[model samples]
Target chain A: MPKAPRAVVLLGAQRFDPTLVEAVKDLGIKGRIAAITAGWQEREEEDDDLEEHLATLSVTTENLRLHARAEEVFRADPEFHKAHRERQALLRHRQDFYRIRLEHALDAAQVIRQRQAPEAILEDEAHASIQAIRDLDHMHLSRCAIDRGEFEDRYRPLKRPALAKHRSEIAEIIAGSEGVAIAGGHVASLLNRLDLFGIAPMLGGKAIFAWCAGAMAISERVVLFHDSPPQGVGAAEVLDAGLGLAPGVVVLPQPEFRLRLDDKERVQLMARRFAPAVCLAMPERSRARWKSGRVESQQGGVFELREDGTHALSVARHSVPPMKGHVAS
Target chain B: MTGLTPLAITTLMMPGTDARKVDEFLAGKQFPLTEGPNVTFVWRGDAEGVNLRHWIYGLETATALSRLPHTDLWFLTLDIPEGSRIEYKFEVLRNGKGEWIEDPRNPNRARDPFGANSVLQAVGYEAPDWSTKDDLARPGTIDQLVFDSPSLEGRRNVQMYLPARFRRSRQYPLVVVHDGKDYLNYASMKEVLDNLIHRLEIPDVIVAFTDSPDRLREYANDEAHARFLTEELVPDLAARFPLYDRPQARCLMGASFGAVASFSTACRYPGFWGRLLLQSGSFAFTDIGKRNRRGPLFDRVVEFMNRYRNEPVAVSERIFVSCGVYESLIYENRSMVPLLDATGMQVRFVEARDGHNWENWRDRLREGLSWVFPGPLMFVYE
Candidate 1:
């Protein structure tokens, strides 16, 4: 059999969503697939357990470490130190606030618990009342992060060793794989760095697959929607060129939950402004296969564009059902 | 010890009202209160009569009033447009005090960072140029024509966009889009193509927007709509335009259910369409609850794939796929991406931060068209 394509899996910033890994395996073109967990500096014992689980799939898991020299540079940077201090302060404040809130909430729950009397005529109702209080307390504690404005900064920074290891492992994976699949937050940044280091070129002869952030990183440009005054990353903004694995603009995938017209228009405007070599929008589960220049869809999906100043939709046969009710006559 | 204080009085007046007397009284005076609309008279709290302290007035009350009193008030009566609802506010000295306050007369107010308060009239939008329907007529090249699909009679309308460079002189690629009206009219697709072609982004191409006929049934069934595009519409468009006779030059694109049609048609007739652009396609056969009640659409898709897995693509074609970052169907799209890539076909997958919509689709059009036809004549803005 054709050597199963060697595969490299990158996981660092975001926790791996199990469903994403299963999807990769389902593709069936596999050799050795490895997961490099290099985003976090200090790995807890629980992380080792997760690594073990990943190993069961014939995928090796390793933690990449940064060199001492890089660590020295990071420590010497005043701005980095300042930012780190601010983050620490913010974290402490949040922790204190949450602790107080949790205490208060638990106290309220205890009060409700004490009100439940065994002799009460409505025993089930009284138990439900106590449960409801506990649920409310839990919700309050969960929402404490929002109140403290530290939700975004909650993720602790990874140590230098971990960061360097991740970069090296990703490079190694790309070099060995017949194909590579990457999924996670920070995938775009990682891809850009890899491209800069010429790691992406190693996979030039192989097929590459990226989902969500991973997909965005491989494109010519990655548009970040998380920032205010929306900004474009990768080649367009000169932040860093993407892996250049795919030519064109990378659209940050938009969900289909809010059925608003203006929201759709905003997305279109962003795409036009960025004007990547290609723009991709995944409103649903759609796949397009490219072969020798011919791109074909294997599922139900739609692609729209302006032609001669008019818009057109290319519909795949199997995916046209949900849209049956909305087309104009 | 001797203490002395002078009492000053000031009066307020509305715009277009006589306020010359009040202005003269407050000239060079300390603690002076300026005259404004909506205030009839004022009293001074200051001991010095030389210093006008406050002014109040019910300057004017008229339904046809042009301007109200407040900071930044400019009133020049002219023939304003009819049926216009103007917003304005009046500022007046409160109870003989120097404090000028906003009008209590106006009912409309706007919320802002400062606080909720009245605002000036908003400029109305000029009417769009709806004067001519010249676009209704078919161009000379495509011979602007309309088709009533017997398969979708009265159920759908299909619009064709022939490149401005379209000539009876040569054959051109044909691309079929599912949401005809959205592509042709709503998205200004014709203009996009014109610009793209002018910029030489893609080669000369003909676009036939075959609207979904009862989008629910046609897109869901896939068979009906696919048949309509391949069997009925393709022949019709070819007869009308100088379309390339071979399927190698043919392409399909759409989003959601429209995406389904694009892939299904290509799979069914692998030789017919050489290019495809799938944006946020609904490829998860299990999730489409009601539509797949009879049977799973995935079976058909898999069957098509199995049948055509080894078939040599007539002409090297390209496929572009993309989805939103937060879209629930992202996993499904990811799953499908590898499947398509495994077919030994060129696949470009894209992910954006938005859900399924025309905006992203319009952008995808720009990129996908360029990929499908990487030559001069594809749509691009100047």
Candidate 2:
């Protein structure tokens, strides 16, 4: 089997500043890293953030318009557009019910927090509650997989004549670049485009650096979360199956905003919910390194969610290594 | 203190009352002296500055709290009704910009998108005896679950309060509460439910606290939020819980945008929620006469309120609206009452002597919830 990508996740905000610059130097890369800002959506072409960050370095940045290219594919094929829209709407419809059930589980966990139950019983309740949410996530993911599987079984998007030119172009660009940098934006939009042009296969056995939604999109699963939003209520949700470049780690970008750090119950629940995977909070100036498909180091206040309801940047990265593939629930 | 009846002067105690909601402000404060209909509110606070104003919502403007001599404290005694509960904050003007703050001593509070407010419960506003913890009273079980949403591209929590007396053979009413966490920590809803059910004040209900992933964007008259409630939440809840089958048995509730969530859901999915318990709803509208005119912050709220006004539809069988006299949304809520009446729905509109906060909603529960899901003993007491 191909070795998992040697990926390093830096915080989304101020990701490329001195931190990313230092990371680039640490990796000792001399060639260009084909940077993918597909996550930026409409501003996919804008690399000012990347350009400015690496202005002094010999390492070059190449912008890949995966988002634009995906849009072109949709525009080129009417049948594919109809299928994609229908797929999205169906997932949304199904996801509503999934969310309802998920809320029920979270409420149960919240209730468990209030009771003066024994530690053992509390653990049991917490474990069961977390498992329940995980199970719901699994089911929703399965349905999504099926939906996409059905679509791909017929369309065979990569092999289609309409997508041949774009597919070959991306393959050649990624092959030429020594590394790839993915930026953040609308995660769903980014993931869809990356999936359409088949970046994951091309990214195999490559050096990858991602931040924010970019970091989240590279992992085995994409979990969207927020604690206090300007307009909406806060809930940590599993958005979709990711590219699986960084395995066994749920990268939580901007944990300061997304996490209810003071709320012990929520902290404990989130940690236990995405257990074994190490719900790593990628705050600003933080980094998590994966070498040969395993976590090698953590720095700059990078922390992992623990079962005991504590967050820490465990000194020993070898203690919880990243597996090559998905850690089955 | 002024122009009050003998009963209104009966100095109700200010300590030991439940905070009801703690996330908003300090709790366990409020002394009320009441006659038959009106009551006097006495609140104590410590001030660090001269311009100590009570930035109470629902009312027209802030009122200055008379500072006591030789003390860091200030007192405000205002007369209101027998069952009015309001939310208020102390605005200390320090270095120009007003600092809105919570009552240091008062335990009861309510929270909105803006911030926290101390709650004031008037006399005769009994928050059901069962709402209080009694070792003898059998409590319900609340469980948390995750709900995935593709439309909003999110997954949120759903808090379900199943009564201690749940049985597969038995059916119960469902009350969907928006702003789930606020209702839980702030409103003390779970305790309220246990107490209400134990007392049989309301029918045994399976309440689902439907949390908002985005309250401002999702809850403020947004159809997707409504769909999440009706299409996703309720249906999924009905499938699992042995809930009362009729739409009339279900209730949707919230305070502020949460109230807007309930109102908009009821409007969008008519009959989904049999009742709406709106407390100081931010129902901004300019078309409900000149008094309803509002600002740009209220533009989206105005659009929604106008849509419902132009097409007055039967959202719920009965609606209970409670807005504090000292709340920011009083005019808008006042405009809503007449419009609700015009919709041919049985409406009970209450003007709380307090402000826009959760205590106002918590105190009104006895009236609103009991009316919506009146138990068998409702007539016996009457």
Candidate 3:
């Protein structure tokens, strides 16, 4: 039987959006697929949606739960637990400082947006404002990585027997399955489980489909951003360093909700701040596929932010070539 | 506000009843229910000498009914708005207690997160059968478009609701709603429109479910958002669809900040979008730029609202404002009513007892749509 090429497929939100199912079916695999849904917290077994989708294609599924089994890790390794707590505390402190700087920079940007400053002055102010935010993010993200790495190096939590049991179980599951489906939720929770179990190595280059926090977890860095929330304005924070799987892009899921994409200054600042890492806007139905370490298709209405505070669709739509223009300050 | 008189009287043919004849009345005809433009809602065996009002239209929306002529049939023959789907319950003063009870006879009901309420589709109003998916009916098509906005310098996916009877050749009234997905999914607007258009309650219109990439920043009376709607989107829509060009045929709508977006668009582009359907709008404003003390999220929103208040410009020709009585922003919406009414624009204000939610906005859709786009067939009895 002809099979789809083994690859990593990054998708948008899948709770309501069934793009993941479509991607999984397109893989053309009849074998059982392992699933990671620790990100969903306690309600991990509620895999009815994924199950329903797979049932249509007649694919057997194995929903691997790291969340339900995290108690073992905590129970066995007291040192790892302490280290993890310290690391979380440090991360929180780092976030507080980052937030202060972010707030200040955002205030400056708001002032700049409202100001009728000269073009040169406006550009300078905007440039500095964006730089400040970028510096803050970079510093925070770096600090988080160092802190987590130090904890891991000191504790060697992955080597703990409690987690070792889960690792063997996950490895066995992945060995049988031709692919893996990772659903999104709490990104930290998802990453913690994935790292604890160390299932990435067991994948053996099998095809993986992930979306939302799942996609964010596999990225180089997981950024949490929301422009306006119910309580107040929200600043985008680099949550933590992700598993270096979906390389080189800030996966901003629900861009429709979080990003003020319409605002030139905000969008432009975001583009420049996250320079090099293509800040990919993944709303529902957005898709980006990586085959053999190469991004093959970013065609499912995927958009990439540019340096000049403008975004263009990664794929063409309705034969209308991508609109290209730098935003006027 | 203009007062309306009942066009016709509708009498129940069943036997007259008091508390003694309750069983007989029950066996004969369903009490507390009537049909017509002027239909009396009867509540059997009510104890008088207490504050009581018939909860009509929506939750907490009530009217006092006079005891019907010569019987215990407590009835009020109200000439309801020509085309309206009203929800009502009885507040009976019985056993020294006043409690609300749904019209047991009326089978039509609508439920939200709160609870259920009995619905009344008036003579001219037809309850959308498509509100519930019917296999027999041909469903309307919803074409999703990822529009690259030139004005705002971004891309947003808009869900366009084209009626089953849609044709490119015919110019249709255009209704642009904010929070496209919420209305379509949460509010079940596609179903409502499908049924409405199917039954000819509303005209076959082109609905552009325009979503906000960032709702708070854009919809808080933001200039960029206004430009995006009027400048970027409108022209794009005109080129694509057979849209009615006149302002009268164009409706800009939304709820919460979405309402602010529609209103701000109307203020910015006065002659462009004339029909406004604002549901539970966050018309946040402060005098002399004194911020709302809540947070800075609404600071700019207040600034814009104040600007509109200071310079009260005639935004639209006809406007329908719906809000929930239990909402925190009730004052804001209520304040906007008089402000809008004073602007020489036809303004209709409606409210329900429920809190601010998608369902509250959803229930107001039929009333708002029918009034805004009554088409040529619906006679305007002024």
Candidate 4:
């Protein structure tokens, strides 16, 4: 495996209007940039607009086509494909069971937060409630790890000729590229392709730029969150362990559209529940760069959620470092 | 006075008030003046007789608005329930011939295919912000799917809503909407779907928007129409697009007669369509006598509803039924909810203050779609 990446830059959703060119310029990345739009699945080849946009900066992009390669591997080895399918089903089942507990724990936390009581007692109970949610998240992630570990142990996917051939090609692309740009789409599909090809090992010692689902996939943990869904009370749950490229951060993409930030209780609850790891809310035009296991630089009104409320990154910069001390729950 | 509710208009109704005071009261004040549950409607100009014509069931259809003693202002105040949204027009009598016109003072209007009506939102009612197009939300594209259906013995054109960033490898849930054109034109279906999906309120799914050539006959729970949707359209769509084959991912939705078509279609192929969203269904059923008072159009609708009520089988896994309290079909929709729930299926029922119109159906789309096919908000992390 190569050395750790020089830096990892995460951004908001880039579908409607992308600020990727601005981010790329800020990083001073020139020459060929390896692009992974595997999350786009069958439409992975349809990156004309993205390619044109990058061409303006005089930066050529090479799509890794991890999704297509994964498909090829599956076709070549039906046994590995069946095992992958079974693993996905197991993960889904785990998530379904996890949600039931997560919801109840969140509900209990909310109730305690709202209860009319003395401030000191309320603070204690609120912390306890948040801990319960954290415990549930930890438990869920651990179980997901077990499922993934079992699959990897049984199949030993990297040893297989089908996946090994593609991995070597992808490694060659990364070796020749200045930086890697991962675009967002279906997060699960994106993570699945990333995991199957084992691209994390090759991502070291290069500048990495990812946005939306891409940002979440590279983080320490993949957290699915929405404060106000149409039906039922939405509780953010741990999907699985991420690529761990950008450690000590839980990246929430498009928070301006997903989260009810004005609600202090919900904000505080989310921040405290995911304590140690910085919960970053990346809205449109937002950018955050991680280097040396800390937030090196950030732009836009990117928010760092706290126990009181969400503070802009300018005022909350100090909180991101302690996040590195405790990377996992 | 600019923000005064209709209940406060009594001060202007005093006998001593002159035209100057009335003009001052009218200047810049939004109408119909809504204060709590009381809404005061004001109409300006001369007429032989003026009446407030509204489409609210169980209430007087036309209530005369008395003209102030010395002013041209005609005012009528009524106690409208909080959270109720109603559409009304002023019936101005000119030379013994009545002409119905939208409110001159009320700027809020709801447009339908026929025309537009003045909108009155009571105290707690607010139009959903998500229904409007947002520049930030990525818009979904609509494509036409033309096919020949042997079941209907004709060619059918369906407009498909492929969500932004749609992928062929990902299998999406399917929502087949009846009366598709009306939903697109009046309900703002595309905008709502785009916003809802962008906001993670509902999953990014493929929508098959279908319209009938002969809506009255075909949407009356006709057997051929059911076959056309289940046997023909669905198979073609599945073959063309990457859609989930499971019943849980399939849904059938419509409003009024179109709603009847969705319900009957799901019933015919039980467990095939797992979700049903029926809005203001024209379920005119007779508990005792077989008399149908809703005219010839409702003859077949009443027959299907009556038979379904008697059997009350579990057709779908989940059913979301909504109706306007002001609509004549409210009683039927309300009664059908309990019967549907009794079938051991998940049932959700919602009621609004508005009448049977496209906007009312449009307002319920978010809740219906989200509840049926909840998005990544609840489950998927990436």
TM-score of each: 0.33, 0.53, 0.46, 0.75
Consecutive 10-residue window with the lowest summed lDDT within model 4 chain B: B1-10
- Comparing 1 with 2 on TM-score, the higher-scoring candidate is 2
Candidate 4 per-residue lDDT, tens place, A185-277, comes to: 778888888888888877777889998889988888888888877765567777777787777778898887678888887788778878777
Model 1 segments more than 4 A misplaced: A1-329, B1-144, B148-156, B286-316, B377-382
Clash counts per candidate, in order, are: 126, 52, 2, 2
* Best prediction by DockQ: 4
lDDT of 2 by residue, B155-259 (tens): 878888888878875568888888877777766777877776666567678888877656787877787778877888778788898876666678898888888
Chain A TM-score, cand. 2: 0.90
Q: Give the winner by TM-score.
A: 4
| Tens digit per residue, CA lDDT, model 4, B1-382 | 3345335688886778888998898888889987767788999898888999988999999999999888888998888888899988999999999999999888899998789999998899999998999998999999998989888888989999999979886778999999998899999999999999988778889999999899989999899999999998888899999997878789999999888999999988999999999999988898876658888788888888889988899989888999999998999999999999899778889898889988898899998888888776543332
Better model by TM-score, 1 or 3? 3
Comparing candidate 1 with candidate 4, which one achieves the higher lDDT? 4
Top lDDT prediction, candidate number: 4
Interface RMSD score of candidate 2: 21.1
Candidates' lDDT values, in order?
0.45, 0.70, 0.72, 0.85
RMSD of 1: 27.5
Per-residue lDDT for A98-181 in model 2, tens only? 765787788787787678978999878767878888899888778777877787898888887767788898888888887888
Q: What is the TM-score of chain A alone in each candidate?
A: 0.44, 0.90, 0.86, 0.93
